[model samples]
Structure formats: structure tokens, C-alpha cells
Target chain A: QKEVEQDPGPLSVPEGAIVSLNCTYSNSAFQYFMWYRQYSRKGPELLMYTYSSGNKEDGRFTAQVDKSSKYISLFIRDSQPSDSATYLCAMSRGDSNYQLIWGAGTKLIIKP
Target chain B: DTAVSQTPKYLVTQMGNDKSIKCEQNLGHDTMYWYKQDSKKFLKIMFSYNNKELIINETVPNRFSPKSPDKAHLNLHINSLELGDSAVYFCASSWGQGGADTQYFGPGTRLTVL
Candidate 1:
């Protein structure tokens, strides 16, 4: 089984709508969680980052991680067409290796 | 300016052929990584280098080799490429291999093998 699992969503939402993207992991050793946005034919861009089991907010985006549940989420407020992109959740355990395990990206489309 | 860059943004080759994708990062980062995004959009780490030294090498096949000429460059070479090698390869770099500090990714190279 993949360490991280995420729905490969083609979720479409109208502009200004709130969007929630999530991922689940089997490894409780994961301590750092991150959300990345990737546009068509482009590399993944870092969107939100959180450490362990708490919520971190930056502007209209919020990242929440529940270590006990091994679940993480990325929330986008006032979503725009420009925000349309694949959202990928990634995690890693610190101190030993720096390699991050990734999930299959969820494709998101924002309607204008 | 492109902080991290990869050559041959689109690579098309046939099976049994040998090819290499070159990557360079201008962010002055000590650590660099190579990741593969399969058709299912599953991104997996292939290799990583820190300051011209080999660090993290995943469970990749021996046919897939990564070379780092310096701290700023990490290149991937595939010998006897197979059809399963068709995927987008991305190069990324981080300021340090620590903390929640994010790694910056380069525009990926899409490889299509016949």
C-alpha cells in the first residue's frame, strides 16, 4: 500500500467558493506535512506547510494536520480560476532521511 | 529567473535507448533531489544529493543513475530505458535538508518512451 493516499479529484468549484483537499497516511512516523499546487505541465509549487498536529494559516489558505488520525487537509478561501491546479500532499519524518513521500495529486479546477 | 531548471523540457525516445536529463539549481541550496511523476501523477523520489555528495538514493533500479558534478547540479541518466520510463522528472532543491522549509522545484522534463 502507498504510504500516502489522496483522491485524484477533478473537483470543480465556482469562483470564490471554499475548497478543501485532504490526504490520509498510514505512517504515524510522519511529522511534517505539506500541500503543493501544480499547474498543467508545470512543477509542484509549495502552497501550505504544517508541522506535526496543528493548524497553520497563511492568507486565504490554511493547513491542518491531525497526527493521531494521520490525516491532513488544505483549505482554500476565495478560490479563483488561477487557483485551479493539482493539489499534492507530502510528508516526511525528520532527523534520518530528507526524502519526502508524496501522494497522487488531486486535480482541481476553478470555474470563472 | 528560473531558480531550478532542467534540460530537454520534453524528451522523446525509444526503448533500449540511453538518455540523460540534466538539472541545475541556482538557489545556492546544498541539497538537491530528483523525483518522478508517473502517468497516474504519483510523484516519487529517485535520488538526492547534498553538497556534491550522494545522500538519499531510493529503491530505484540500477539502470537509473544520478550524478552530481557539484552542489548546484544533479543529473539523471537512464541506461537501456524501458517503456515504463515514460514520465515527468522533476528536480528540486532546498536551502537545508532540515525543518519544515520547503523545497523549490524546477519545471519538469516530460519523457515519452516508445
Candidate 2:
């Protein structure tokens, strides 16, 4: 099994709808969780970041992490057509190497 | 002012040819990284440098080599590239090597190996 698993979803949602993207990992040592948004033909950009098991909110975006279940989620409230992109989840153990294990991004389309 | 930038935005090269991708960050960051995103959008770290020193090196083939001339520059050179080397390469920089440090990524270099 991959260290981090995420559904490569072309999840289509109507504008103004709420969108939830999730990722599951088998590693228990992950302490830092992050969500990145990538547009077509562009590099990934950091969206939300959270440490350990808790929720962090930034405007319309909320990031939640549950260490016990090895699960992480990113929720988008009142999504817009401009939010259409690939959402990628990444985690790290906070070790010296500080290498991030990334999930296969989920493609989200917020239709107008 | 771009925080992170890469040269040769699009590169198309024949198999067995050598090429290089250059990365520079004006953010004065202490850490830089090289990542490869395959056609499936699976991003993987290939190498990392901290203070111009090699810190994280993944199990990439020897054909790939990363050089750090200074804290602001990290370059990747591939020798005798293969067809499998076609992918999007990204350069990222952060203030430090900590896991929580926010990384700024470049626009990425799309390489096509024929």
C-alpha cells in the first residue's frame, strides 16, 4: 500500500456547494499536514496547513487532521467555479529530513 | 517578483541526451527541494538541500544529480536521460528544513523525452 492514499477524483460540484476532500495515511509519525491547490499547467501552491490532530480554518478553507485514524481533510465552503483545480494532501513526520509524502491529487471542478 | 523561478519552462529532448533545469529563489530561503510529478500527478521528492548542503536524497537513479551553488540556487542535471524521465519538475524553497515550514514552488518545468 502507498504511504499516503487519496482518491484521484474528478469531483464535480455545483457552485456555492460545499466540497470535502480527504486523504488517509498508514504512517503514524506524521505530525504536519498540508493541502495544496494546483491548476492546469501550473505548480502546486500551499493552501492550508495544520499541525497534528486539530482543525485550522482560513477563510473559506478548513483543514482537519486526526492522528488516531491517520486521516486528514480539507473542506471548502461555498465553493466557486474559480476553485476548480487539483487538491493535493501532504504530510511529514517533522523529522530532520523533513521530506513530505504526497498523495495522488484529487481533481475538483466547481461548476457554475 | 517571483519568489521561486525555474528556467526552460518547456523542454523537449531526444532520449540519451543530457539536460539541466535551473532553479533560483529570491526569498533568501535556507532550504530548497527538487520534485518530480508524473503524468498521473503523483509528486515525489527527489532531493533537498539546506544551506547549500545535501540533506535529503531519495532513491532516484544516479543519472540524476542536484547541485547547490548557494542558498538561493539549486540545479538538477540529468545525464543520458531516458524515455521514463518525461515528467513535470518543480523547484521549491522554504525558510528552513522543518516539516511545517511553508514551501514556495516555482512554475515547474515540463520535460518531454522522445
Q: In DockQ terms, which candidate is top? A: 2
> Where does candidate 1 clash, by residue pair?
none
Tell me the docking grade of candidate 2: medium
Cα lDDT of model 1 by residue, B1-114, tens digit: 899999989999999999999999999999999999998888888888889887888899999999999999999999999998899999999976752458899999999999
lDDT (tens digit, per residue) of candidate 2 on A1-112: 9999999988999999999999999999899999999999998999998988999999999999989999999999999999999999999888876788899999999999
Clashes of each: 0, 0
Q: What is the TM-score of each candidate against the true structure?
A: 0.95, 0.97
Candidate with the greatest TM-score versus the true structure: 2
Worst ten in a row by lDDT for model 2 chain B: B94-103
Q: What are the lDDT scores of the predictions, listed in order?
A: 0.90, 0.94
Residues A1-112 of candidate 1 have per-residue lDDT tens digits of 9899999988999999999999999988888899999999999989888888999999999999988888999999999999999999988886545678788989999999
